[model samples]
Target: MKEAAKGLVPASSSVNEGAAPLVERLIAAATELRIGVERLENGVTVLDGGIAVCGSVAAGIAIGEICMGGLGRVRLTTSGGAGAAEGGWPTWLEVASAQPVLACLASQYAGWSLSASKEEGGGKKFFSLGSGPARALAAREALFDELRYRDHAASGVLVLEVDRMPPPVVVDKVLRDCELAPEQLTLILTPTSSLAGSTQVVARVLEVALHKAHELGFPLADVIDGDARAPLPAPSPDAGVAMGRTNDAILYGGQVHLTVAGGDEAARDLARRLPSSNSRDYGRSFADVFRDYDYDFYRIDPALFAPAEVWVSSLESGRTWHAGGIDMALLRRLWLDEA
Candidate 1:
């Protein structure tokens, strides 16, 4: 029953400033709804005393809708560095629709910082870019020219930074006829540690920029971390596993060979039960279906000291199915489309 904080706020007026006010406002808003905010220095905020909503952005939106537009207690986990890199692109485009004329400052200088801000004025949200003075000036001009030719409202600015000179400066100068301000800007800094280590340095700068954007209320839906990559757990020993294309005349190889008999009623039954939508819609006898089917066999490369053979028998014969290495249950699941 708690209400979520509304609106995004700038992270810092200056680089060294803490996010105390932002956190305080968020806490106050949530507290009104009987929710607690747990702030962590590692850039994580936990919402408690309500339903714990945890998942991707899509999941969060669904949860929000279910709560009747209410924001529930949630844990905002970083999805690695995905948010830091590609986040906010859509938001920038959306804002550009309104304020057609805006400057976008991206830094190619070393040791520069970047930030974003959102303000409500004239019944619309105005986003601003903050960065070093040089990048800010250039971004202001570029925005003006973009607005003249475009039909969208001049929303705000997009700041992008790199190790080299940014394109905004040239763009702004080209449209010098229009005057732009230093305040309506977003600054993105791209710094380089060294010419040899440019790539690594650029990557780090990008990550930092993304984090800063998220802190500034850019709604970075998620942040995926690259360092958390890990392998999937092995399957259970008792679980039957088979990997093959669905509803296709195919051959499987392992400790045992399962030769699907063409006309056998049991084979037909098994084929009928194959895990596939096609089988349900277009039921066909296995014999008539795979008339020219050729059985291909392969050995379980490592050789699991077990008896293996291909079972080619007729379904009408009622022959007792015998296979040394075949898991009957798994075969049933695979053919029945129950898996």
Candidate 2:
């Protein structure tokens, strides 16, 4: 595998640079997108998708694209609902990327952890896992080292799934790590209970697949192209429920297709192990699993965090392999109620 990986070309594009223009366009169309915009005291710009405004589906799709560092496309589409009632969902978020590794792992993965506690002089307890193109500039996570990638850009954009503004301390940390002036930073806040949040989270279907494949020890550089989609559930007002719905959307209803440069055997192995059904905790709704685990997210099986279905095509052998199947019954149970 290491020998084959040498043939892979290094990624030369800057994710932060690629996303800067998209960030400008998103802020430029804030009013039309039905989102709120504000500037903090420190001169850092903030865009609110659901906190102070009623965010729309359009804004979510746009944010999803930005989250992928402009390397991926996100769109709203209708599901065919085959072999199930209403096909479990009428709406879905479809995502595609030619640069799957960089788009999903280097950009979209929420691998950076930021937090503030009252004891540490923070105004209140605050925590969020940072995502989007800005992570490439910070390069704080070890994953960046493994990928041997970093970004150099004058501007940066970050997406946070939180209901409130980040503490100024956390913002300061971002400025220091990315070496960006306050004016050069933009923070986007999307709460899970909002339309925008649900859309953007479900849009991570492809990213989740890439992340799982990486975790399973597959050679990421071999993954050349990818596409995926998952059912979009109504955002719940309850925080826990909202989180579960987003996760369950991928665990039960998401599907992904990956194109790789590896041999047929390697591609078949990746396909076999890249689905949620392979985990012991696969039979229940995510909400139920969370409750059973006493709401401690880490206590649950990490293997359960994958798309329900997958397809892998090996360019080397001109063959394709598939594994897993979507569970529409479980999706309908979680998404719909017969009132």
Candidate 3:
């Protein structure tokens, strides 16, 4: 998609190497972060954020940073005034990245689909969209071909949002594809129904915006910087409910600001087209949409995968364009406990 920009822009850093230390740091603070760390017999390190242990918001924040390949910032903040009251959400995740294209699309986009079925020799079925720095090492997605970026590192980490540990065959696949020894690899699991998992998913607000812009035919190289915020939803016990809340947090309440180097008209058009509201399937909760579609994500509209609102600022024109609006009433109805 960004074939032209591939030749024009060079990757500024190795995502794997940048995030390796962050992974170590997260491990070092695991106890305090309320996460579980285990080493497999073959020496692969596994960090469990929510599957077997109680994972906290702090762990999610650290994992979110690692998912960006250490090129982005993810932190918690709070909103104020009537809007916060109406939305019934006060706490939010504030995300920012100076290297928007690389930090988001190249590392945090969850483009690598990894799976191991029972027929594939794993006793149980396993499937997940792998995210984080390990994706750079694998470079399995065609998106990497368009970006023309690869990472060379002695160690790598992958973050998977799953309830169960990956099968041995799946682990072996990652080791082989990433060209890393068992001892040099780490796998972090964050289930969607857990606190840490929900937080980390909501932290992808800015990355989602960047991805949608690319889908909309915006020049990725032109996007210089980006920042976004989305409410931190209460994790639900039901897997479907949890997934819906995380997605709706961004689709209904998320806001994004992108700094681009382009003409004012281009920026304005991007602003007009970048919100989830523009989708034909926009008004309903994502859970309801997912249910109506028989739980198949591919059947849903791709255009609906965007923030609630957006602002695009043209660096050359010194003017900003804005579009869309947040649906706090819908968010409140879905998220609030009126009892």
Candidate 4:
């Protein structure tokens, strides 16, 4: 698996034209090794016919290594989408199994697997299993194969949705069946509004149970909470939350405050003046700005509220930029006095 690099250069720096030299270097290296390359729109470069080299490198190098050698044709694609595209390598398998009626209902809606097996008391049990997106596709294919074996219609199957996190005992069983480690498992919780109310409730319960299991050292990678239209909560802890503009000013220190007036354009101009030239386009949400503000001195709209102020009495050499708060008095003394 290859991890993408961050902090390569300032986002506003146009000198490089968004192309890193390393990409060409890797391409040359691959060509030297006799690997083929296929290019796609949106910066997707796939190496045809090779095993992916597992290591860390610049984004360009990582793609090149994947094109080098492998059991089957291994392709690497990169996008800014949530979660790793293709669910990252060394894939983890996700399974969803439920009562037959429920499974049949879900299958009708989502085209997941639904099958019936006799239970001890004479009722039927329904189940389905899936991996990440690619594996899910594979699972559907396998289901069709199985359906063909049994001479049954396989249209409109629903993937299984679990309500409560599985108990450790149940999780262990699933791990054994999938032959996957706990770290690979990512429990997905569908919100109550999207699914039938009953199903939604169950999903929430399962999510909580799985969270406890994770806290207890289960190897689960994450428990995804899902709601079709719900806004994501702010990141935990003040330091982690991204700042964003509500109207005139940006919110920070748990309150909306005025850092700059005028409007969004002015706020953005102030943002460009900040030392972190890599900050996202000011038109982007405050959360995005916060993510890039590693050295601080962030710009905000002052009309929202009183600006939080910090004093830097003197400049320190080699300090790069400053954090904490800005000194308004000094700013007025320097800029206003000059005016």
RMSD of 4: 23.7
26-62: candidate 1 lDDT, tens digit per residue: 3455544343344333323333322231112222211
State every prediction's TM-score relative to the real structure: 0.17, 0.95, 0.95, 0.18
Residue 192 error, candidate 3, Å: 0.7
Best by lDDT: 3
* Candidate 3 Cα outliers beyond 4 Å, as residue runs: 1-9, 80-82, 85-87
Q: Determine which window of 10 residues in candidate 2 has minimal summed lDDT.
A: 1-10
Stretches off by above 4 angstroms in model 1 are 1-4, 10-339
lDDT accuracy of residue 172 in candidate 2? 93
- Rate residue 126 of model 2 by lDDT: 88
lDDT of 1 at 59: 27
The per-residue C-alpha lDDT of model 1 at residue 278 equals 20
Candidate 1's C-alpha lDDT?
0.23
Comparing 1 and 4 by lDDT, which wins? 4
Query: Local error of candidate 3 at 17, Å?
Result: 1.5
lDDT scores in order:
0.23, 0.88, 0.89, 0.24
Q: For candidate 4, lDDT tens digit of each residue in 288-313?
A: 54456553433433122211211111
- For all predictions, the C-alpha RMSD in Å is 25.0, 2.1, 2.5, 23.7
